[model samples]
Target: MYRSRPGATIKAIATDLGVNPETLRNWIRAAGAGHGRGRTEGAPAVPGSSVEADLAAARKRIRDLEEERDILRKAARYFATETGW
Candidate 1:
């Protein structure tokens, strides 16, 4: 589930799963190290591939959102000055 989300935090996930954040972090680390709960054949061998792609997409989306926010702020200032408010 955490791998599926772009900006999800460990604490948030732990809360959702009713587990401690550190516990979840440990699990993630262990999984990354190929420890605990043997991998299934269907699982992607290169986890970094999907994770990096997701990170890139999330970063791009963040940049786009920041740009939109800046534009909106500028427009608000323009309108405010135009109306002498």
Candidate 2:
């Protein structure tokens, strides 16, 4: 699930899955280590880590939020005008 959603933080995923954040982190670490892709504690991110993907996901999320905000603003304005307030 983590690899599938680049925008999701570990905390968010852990909360959704009803698991502790550290437990989730450890699970991820173990999974990576099993695949020979894990990094040592305090080591830099591995090459497989998708920082670009995460950034793009974040930008997409921002855009979606902005669009929703704009729609709500327009709706509010329409309602206010209708009410003459």
Residue 54 lDDT, candidate 2, scale 0-100: 88
Per-residue lDDT tens digits of candidate 2, residues 1-85?
Answer: 7756768888999999999998988888855643343445665445445777888899999999999999999999999999999
- Model 2: lowest-lDDT 10 consecutive positions: 31-40
* Candidate 2 colliding pairs: none
Residue 36 error, candidate 2, Å = 16
lDDT of 2 at 14: 100
- 31-59 per-residue lDDT for model 1 (tens digits): 66235434566676467888999999999
- Model 1 residue 48 CA deviation (Å) reads 0.7
Each candidate's clash count: 0, 0
Indicate the worst ten consecutive residues by lDDT in candidate 1: 32-41
In terms of TM-score, how similar is model 2 to the real structure?
0.45
